[model samples]
Target: MATYVLVAGAWHGSWCWVEVARMLEAAGHRVLTPNLLGTEAEDEPETTEPLHRWAEQIAEIVRQEVDEVVLVGHSRAGLVISEVAERVPEKIDLLVYLAAYLLQDGQTLNDWAQRAHNADAMTNAVAFHSDGTCTIKPEILEKIFCNRTSAHFIDFARARTVPEPIAAFMSPIQISHERFSSVRLGYIECLQDQAIPLDMQKAMQAPFPNVMTEKLDCDHSPFFSMPHELVSALERFRRAE
Candidate 1:
């Protein structure tokens, strides 16, 4: 059985992948939902670490596994998994992006996001603060992220989201062809995702070819809206590889 590491995006924790991890475990595969450093609600004000800290955490998790791992990143986490692949390419069996920021070397997540300006829902959805942290607009949270989720889950998600550290979003990821490009990649497109639109996802992926792809007809928050379908897509990634 393959080990799966599910990394949540900003403002979220291991809680986001609850259902996905549970389903993967039931199928006899090992699953890890690792929360980034200082991302918990209580850690909001103190969350000053950059994106690479999350990458280091995932790489350590991969080292714990006896074999290669399927690294899955959601939304903003696309950046984190990419960094992890650079650190331990051999330990990673496949790098998976679920409606995430699949940026290239020297490109910051902010650089890719600005192309949309105010057209996409994600631009104004986040409010930046002087303390180098950001907060999601509660009103727009469900709209851009969980619009397709059930009413109960929408509430479930809203209450759990915490403030995010902004340094990671602005930091340029250090990767290279000799290291980062050695790992195989996969992308799971959330066609209905408003947080990161289909066009943006395609643009981020344009630089990388021969990457495995899967599609989901759901919002950005598929973990809450389409966990079964998300698991199905992940299973497809395993089979394809």
Candidate 2:
């Protein structure tokens, strides 16, 4: 059985992975849905937390695990998983990205957002603060991230969502071909994703060859809207990859 460390995206807590974790655990997988540093709703974002810190935290989680780990990241969390995989490539058996921002060595989330045609839906939703924090508008969150999701989940997600540090998006990622490329990459592309559209998802995977690809006909947040399909895809990675 693989130990899965599922990292949450920006403005989201580990709460988002509750249902998904439940399903994975039922299938005999130990899942760790760790809320990244400062992702809590009540936690005040006084100072900016950069990308490396997020990556280091995940790396530490991987280091403590004894079983082969499948490191999964969602949305903004893709950058964290990629950096951590390179940092401890030997421990991470597989890397999974769910409509995430998979950047190169010098690329930042801002760079990819600018390139994505439908990024306005996500970028426009951001409400930046003078204190160097930002959050997505609640109204826009429903349309972009939770489109077609049940009313219950929409409320659950909104209430738990918090402000994300601005520096995390602006921080340039550091990954190398020698270390990062050695590990296998799997991407679950959400075709209807308004946030990170299908085109951008394919473009991000283009740089890396033999990245096992899977598609879901749902929106950006598959774990919420189409969890069964999402878990099925994850299981496919373990068997087919």
Candidate 3:
């Protein structure tokens, strides 16, 4: 059995991976999903946390365990995984980007999202707030989080999504790819994703030519709309080795 550390993107918490984690656990793999800084309303501005701090957290999880881990990152969490791999290369067996932001050295998550070449992106996407928190607009959430997702989830998200710290968005990502060059990379593309857009997903993933890319015919948040399909793809990829 392998241990899997799943990291989520902006405005999300470990709760987002509930279904995916259940499937992985039922299949006998250990899973860990932690909430990032500034995700909760009560949480203070930890988004100022340097990129290394995020990497160290993941590294600590791997260091305490003895099993090889599959580090899976979704959306902006890709930045965290890249840096984590650089910090603790030995513990990770694979790096999986689930319609995630795959970035290179000195690139910020904003840079990837705002690339001009992609035609499908929400060009006006903004993540800032006057109170110093970041959040997506309610209208944008529907397109990004899957319109078919239950109204309950939509309501919950509308009420709960705290403003993301600007640091998480503007902070430059620092990664030493040489450390993770040997790590196998995989990509799961959400073809129907309106938030990231199909074209942008393809563009975001183009840098990693060796990655195993699979298209999920669901919206951006497949974990909410099609848990089984998401689990199935994850299981297949996890067991591929």
TM-score of each: 0.95, 0.97, 0.89
Q: Write the per-residue lDDT of candidate 2 for residues 1-241, one digit (tens) a residue.
A: 7788999888887998988999999999999999888777666663555588888888998999987799989999999999998799999889999999888998899898877777666678889998889988998888889886888999998888898999888888899999998888999999888888789999999988889999999987888999999999998987774
Give the TM-score ranking, best first. Answer: 2, 1, 3
TM-score for predicted model 1 compared with the true structure:
0.95
Against the true structure, what is every candidate's RMSD? 1.5, 1.2, 2.3
Q: Which 10 residues in a row give candidate 1 its minimum summed lDDT?
A: 41-50
Show model 1 residue runs off by greater than 4 Å: 44-49, 117-121
Cα lDDT, all candidates: 0.85, 0.87, 0.75
Which ranking of candidates, highest lDDT first?
Answer: 2, 1, 3
What value of lDDT does candidate 3 attain over all alpha carbons? Answer: 0.75
Number of the top-ranking candidate, with lDDT as the measure: 2
lDDT string, candidate 1, 67-169, tens digits? 9999999978988888998899989888899999998889988888778644555767888888888888888878878879898887777898887878887
TM-score top scorer: 2
Instruction: Output the better candidate (2/3) by TM-score.
Output: 2
